[model samples]
Target: MSARFTRPGAGTPVPVRFPRIVREALDNGLRIWTIPYGAIPVATTTLVIARGTGDDPADRHGLASLTGDLLDEGAGDLDAIGVAEAFARLGTHLDIDVGPDAMTMSSAGLARQIERTLELLASVVRQPRLEAADFARIRELRVNRLRQLSRSAGTVADRAYVSAVFGDHAYGHGALGTTRALEATTVDDVRGFWAGHIGPAVATLIVVGDVVAVDVAAAARRVFDAWDATIGSSRIDRPVVAPDRRIHLVDRPGAAQSELRIGHLAPGRSTEDYHALVVLNAVLGGQFTSRINRRLREEQGITYGAHTSFDFRRAAGSFACETSVQSDATAGAVRDVIAELGRMREAAIAPEELAAASASLTRGYVRNFETAGQVARAATQLAVHGLPDDTFDRFVPAIEAIGADQVLDVARRHIRPDEATVVVVGDATVTAEALTAIDRPLQASAPEF
Candidate 1:
């Protein structure tokens, strides 16, 4: 890890100046946020489509995912091989990913090669040809992956955990959708998806690194200006909240141990309690030496590792703790975790521990922007959500401002043990028996297995 703060006696501090904000919209409804960082000749661009898996129609569960993957196969006039050769020749680093909430395509290359990079990016987005054969190939790839994933205790537990917590909601499904969904996907389905989801209307084009605002904006306009401007803006419908608590077990036969996952709903990235909850969770279960990890792993010898984290999505997210341990120790380990969580909520934290967690959090906050890629992504997030450009600058003060009492208060309010959904994946007979031994009800149903 790099040093999170400036060293003592470092040269006199120079006031950091971020790029000035410049925003514009093309005639076709594309929005752009440009930040010029001319210290180096490398330019990075992030092209984000607001539509993601959550926007998929009920009948087209994996359409968005399929569309994202197919974009690089062939576009406009470039074949898949040709596109790869082009980017390689230019020494550009390009990546494309589709998530539950959004789809992003980004690249970084020498500023001199930006025009060609943009051309490749635009072709991928505007003219993707989702061939029937390619669709079948990708589907086969995904199905094979699901088969291999079924053999892992940890994978089974995570799938069951989310399903048990979110039920039939969109958030319940993984970004790739289910194996059955992938099987039913078709080439035309993905093409139609690209038409609706990947366009200027849903676009948030971000250019950061060593380039002027005017020149970067011109590059964006050259590539995306003629692209269809009429695709409608993307919108996500509201989701129904899941129930407070439940226990779900996914049974994988012939397994010696159980993989456990406990989940609860929590605030999203935009919540005001976000910073306080980060501190609270770090003190409770977020760290290697956190209360839950120390008590369950070090003291009880329940598992090799245990950790908790908030999903941090655009809407309300899930908080989850995951670990795999001996089937016989499964229930006891879970109970110990719950006990520590309750203790953290009920008692005031020791001042030294609280300070340490706060300091650690402060350090992590500073490290978040050390790379050009990180800065580009953060800038895109700010533009997409209309957040303050100074969002991260206030992070340290916000964490430091949180009082110990406030951490306890948030813990008490957010960490509800009874409302949690617990999932254990292992042999059905042994797993259910173990859970039953702990006085929790056990139902022998089909797990995400």
Candidate 2:
């Protein structure tokens, strides 16, 4: 007879020399952070604007994102096809990411081609032709995406939850926006947003891998220094949750599963309790072995998996648990999820749990700097949030130092079960009665999608 044993435990935490970053600025205000990560011959160049979807006019919810989609369609002397072919000729990949807080333009290619890639990116941002044909085509594609989002339970729950949490605030709507808002969007709107929000004062240029700071700055100035247009630099007011709003749902008729989002508005990215909150989330639902997942997925068998996150932006953020479960188990699953959220504040954290969570975060922290692209992305966060240059240098030790009491304090301060907003997308006809049976009074709203 033989006995089965679990796998080996995590190794002793090791020290890593995080990339030493050089911060330089153009005369016009675009910050340049160049990190020399060599031996790979590849470089990733990124340009970021501090404004993103949250900066979209309340009336024009998707303007920022739609403008991003049109950036590379036609630029400078190149038509849509020509622009694509130009980047292809350089063997570079161009990617645009528009999130709640910022818009990132990234190009990754051979180190020697980095200058040309930067030139192409500059053309897209500074001189996009913004052709009528491109706008109509891209706008239609976005409209199609919004249509499809209505049918997916996960997206339905996501949009509903965000809306419920923030109400009509700028952060309330998803980047894709509602059908009415997207349909009403015009090319003139795209051009206007481009002219207003894209500029050096609000931008940060980060170059990583096999590049020197002097060269990146020289190329950046040559391309962008003379272009000093910086408008729409206003900050987003911190969002407030609707006091009376508790539970929100979108009816998905005959759906077999229910997608749930439970959470509330929490502290922003710059909180002093950042490290403790990280450990708190790791214990709550940020990891597979977390409290919420262990209770709902491993013990009760209600969900396949469950996860939580603290989405930190500049001025504000959210703490949420997301999962999909059988429709019949929605109420019980929601109850159990809320209970675990409370448990963090209501109960003492076990020493093993604290050690495991700290290990989970610290052990793999170094992996974030393994590639040039990874470094670019990680650095983007620092620049976008106006974090100090030494953030990466302090990450592992910060997480390792979070103790049980500190995590509990952050959990109590940030995780708000009482104010939590519950969002579910499922067959409401079947879910309504059970949801109402729980201790929390339930409220329903028509799908916001």
Question: 5-106 in candidate 1: lDDT tens per residue?
Answer: 744332222223344667878877787777776577887888887778777777556678778888888777777887788888889756888876778889
User: What is the TM-score of candidate 2?
Assistant: 0.97
Q: Give the true-structure RMSD of model 2.
A: 1.5
Best by TM-score: 2
Q: For residues 296-370, could you state the per-residue lDDT of candidate 2 as single tens digits? A: 888999888999998888888888899999999999998898888888898669999999999999887888788
Q: State the local distance difference test value for candidate 1.
A: 0.75
Candidate 1, superposed: residue stretches over 4 Å from native: 1-20, 232-238, 242-244, 383-386, 445-449
CA lDDT scores, all candidates in order: 0.75, 0.86
- What lDDT score goes with residue 335 in model 2? 88
